[model samples]
Target: MLRELPRIFVNIAGYRDTELPWTIKDLFEKARHPERVFAGICRQYAPGEDDDAAPDGVFAEQCRVYDVHAKDSLGVCWARHQTQKLWRGEEYAFQIDSHMRFVVDWDEVLLDMLGECDSARPVLTTYPVPYTPPDKLDSPVLPVMFARFFDNDDIVSFGSRISLPEDAPEKPQPSAFVAAGFLFGPSKLIADVPYDPRIYFQGEETNLAVRLWTHGWDFFTPNKVVCYHDFSKRPERPRHWEDKVDWRRLNTVSKTRLHHLLGMEKNGDPEALKGIENFGLGARRTLAEYEAFSGIDYKRRLINGKPGRIADLPAGSPERKADRKRRFTFIKESNGWGCEETASGGGSTMAQTEAIRRDLPGVFDSLNIRILGDAGCGDLNWISHITGGLQAYLGFDIVDSLINEAREKFYDRRNHFFSQVDIVIDALPECDAIICRDCLTHLDHQEILPALKLFKESGSRYLFATTHFLGKNTEIKTGGWFPIDLTAAPFNLPKPLITISEEAPNSTKSLGAWKISDLL
Candidate 1:
């Protein structure tokens, strides 16, 4: 049964010029049995010459890397093809991007979830609610959602509810298909049900969801194990609406193709796809400006060698490096976590409440508790509650009340709060061990060294964090600020403390525990 457990396969379709994120590298490091996981690099349509390079360093240690060459038109199709060619006999299969941040034993969780499923069932996922959302429409946010296709009303209340039926056959219906990051049945299921090659851009997953529903295959959601994409950073607004319009047009075309193929047009009426047509005027305006200003030759560029899409770049270019640095510092100072001087402030009170709540008996049994920053009276309340004695203290800044308040209103207080790198670091307490649950990648490159220094000074014998490498190419934001090119770099932080465990899935409640003496 153990041997038959599905191998973890990561599909990086456009990871050619893009460096894997540190969070992903951490996954490789934390894997309980790294050998069991397999990483497949789909470099098929990268415009430039074949670098044929393997992700170097630790990732190279335990992963079987494959470089598959294909084209953008066959993006998802190629990925599905590779899954079939490899991992055919595994117990379960998962598809995730190279930038996902994880805090638990994902493999075991996936295996357990797959085991719970009847072999005949299908599994899909929704985007992990971002740890943070942008303040406004023009903020530097990741375009994680294809807002064009999703009905705002439908997504507003979307939560643990599995809108798609578990046993419903593949049929055309109003379904909110969980796109991009998700796990499904055995690799053979996807291999047999390959993504429609006709989809040149997005909407493939939506189409697949519809197809699966029509086929009577059931879908499942664990609602427990959770992971997040690197969508915390927002992008600058495009100078011209045409850039936005052109992308919207392309999205429209994809959606049109999907609707037509699915026979979603009512009474054979083409107007059923009117939602797509309505956006035409706006799309045309944006495209016109985009073509005139950017001079983008869509055809030649269609086959162009840009490693990943333009959207992957940071908000600004080289000139904005200083601004990025300033923002990073501001984020660290404002939203990061820290110990309260007194338990009187709202921060202290909140910490006290969480510490008291989480310290319940048997709570720390499976979970590890390491507080960063200073050990304040409020933080000590939590330390005393959790079973394992305060193990480590990795100091970071404190959370900004404004950000915390915004988070509370917008996100689930339980999951989203801790996911915030800025907030978590701010609330850290002094201890012997440091536990960073996929929180390190959000730090600026410059802050990493100082943060590490603080961790070392906090009397912490062990430090747990994640990192990725920096790629050569860079992205620029419209605001004229350019942060480090994260997509191009994989994380590269050294583990000074005891290497207790490799990658293991963690519960949304708690990740794992570490002994302070282990590092000594």
Candidate 2:
């Protein structure tokens, strides 16, 4: 960074090591202006090593080295605190690991690239394509463009990259996983979402992502390569987990802190909650909104654009289903998820809710009802009529735009509320009866069964779902009401009460109803 930029101050946080000053001395002399570069280092000295071991010279003018007693070493967080305390409020900042190499003009290019962002508060990061075998510096690899997710024992998520894009754009791609090794953004933003001293290391990235996103900060990957990380010397470097203590036990404690902040560990995890009490969420959005926007359901550790839960992918050969998310494919080909509903189109919801209010008093007046894949409360008023006498009512949908609109237009928080989509993975609050509209038909067959099983497991004694199964032989057209067989694989609903021949509501062309006991 010093070689590339004329006025960049470097913060080299060293813990349990004595080589930081020696390393900074070399870089300080090589930098364009030695006075501009400030090194805030936390060094642990050997027993006989002198505190002023760093030779006083021109480079010493810009160094603020801390003598953290070697015997007092606790974790990397303590070292980080010492390093960050040297902050004098610069405009922009870049946090990187000690072992890394940079491309030519990286600093200048990165600063200019920040101007290409679409958001007022943008953070630039990525798992930069590897640059290995120092001798083979010319070998080119593109930055990770696409994000793929996998769960980490419900602790957090793991991200993998798709093949590099052939034709890359000049601007950075918006990213959800904040690469801790390489992050570039405004100094205040970093200060706002600073590292938590309680968390050692395992869950720092996730914690940063949640805090930044909720604070209305957006993240993106630099289309151009800013720098490359050298992974060859990981063992040679000092790590927080290297101490003699039970690191595994510490990691378990860290996971609890992560789950609590994400709102996943609801029952208990008070210790975790207290760890993050000082670092609160920003005013821009909620964690659920962040999950919906990024398409990474933290509760489920699943992502968008993959054949995962809640992704309504199509039925075909594995070739078509591979690496594709149902919602992305549909929205790409058509206007959007074909589930948009207005008052006129959702007339059936009125009829259905009224029937429940009139025909099923014992169930409607006392039981809690959860409507999955509730597109929009097109029948909000009518549904409220039935739910008014009921114990409670909750509606959830995948399309967040519709959910947000419906939540604002109708439903009081005291009794009736709607939330984000979590169909196939995260368990919903238990309900007495689940009133699912024609939503099953929208899911990939692989997801339908798990979804049904999850709904049944929600303590729902009765299931009144209107989605249907195709007959023995039939070709189904997608993007509208299509052939979705709920009885096919995992879910074998005995048979519908009666296959309603009547034309269905907006999201679907036709539909039917099924009961919970029938499915069992």
Best by TM-score: 2
Residue 13 CA displacement from its true place in model 1, Å: 2.9
lDDT of 2 at 67: 65
Compose the digit string of candidate 1's lDDT tens values, residues 1-520: 5475446655554333232434447566555655576665444433344343235556664444455543332344445445445453454556765445554576665565556655355564555433332111121121122222112101111113322234333322222344556544556445445554434345555455545544444455443434555554322211111122243344445555564543343333354344432212121123323323322222222112331222222323322233334444433333223224422233234343363334322433333433333211112323223323333332232333333443445353231222223331223334534644333334434433344445555565444432222343233331122222222333233323222222223411122333433322
Q: Which digits, one per residue and each the tens of the lDDT, describe model 2 over residues 46-135?
A: 446534434345467666667666556545554665667776765666665444456555556667788899889988887655545332
* Model 2 misplaced regions, further than 4 Å: 1-9, 15-35, 44-58, 69-71, 129-138, 145-148, 160-166, 233-238, 267-272, 305-520
lDDT of 1: 0.39
The 10-residue segment of model 2 with minimum total lDDT is 471-480
Query: All candidates' lDDT scores?
Result: 0.39, 0.56
On a 0 to 1 TM-score scale, where does candidate 1 land against the true structure?
A: 0.38
Q: C-alpha displacement of 152 in model 1, angstroms?
A: 12
lDDT of 2 at 220: 86
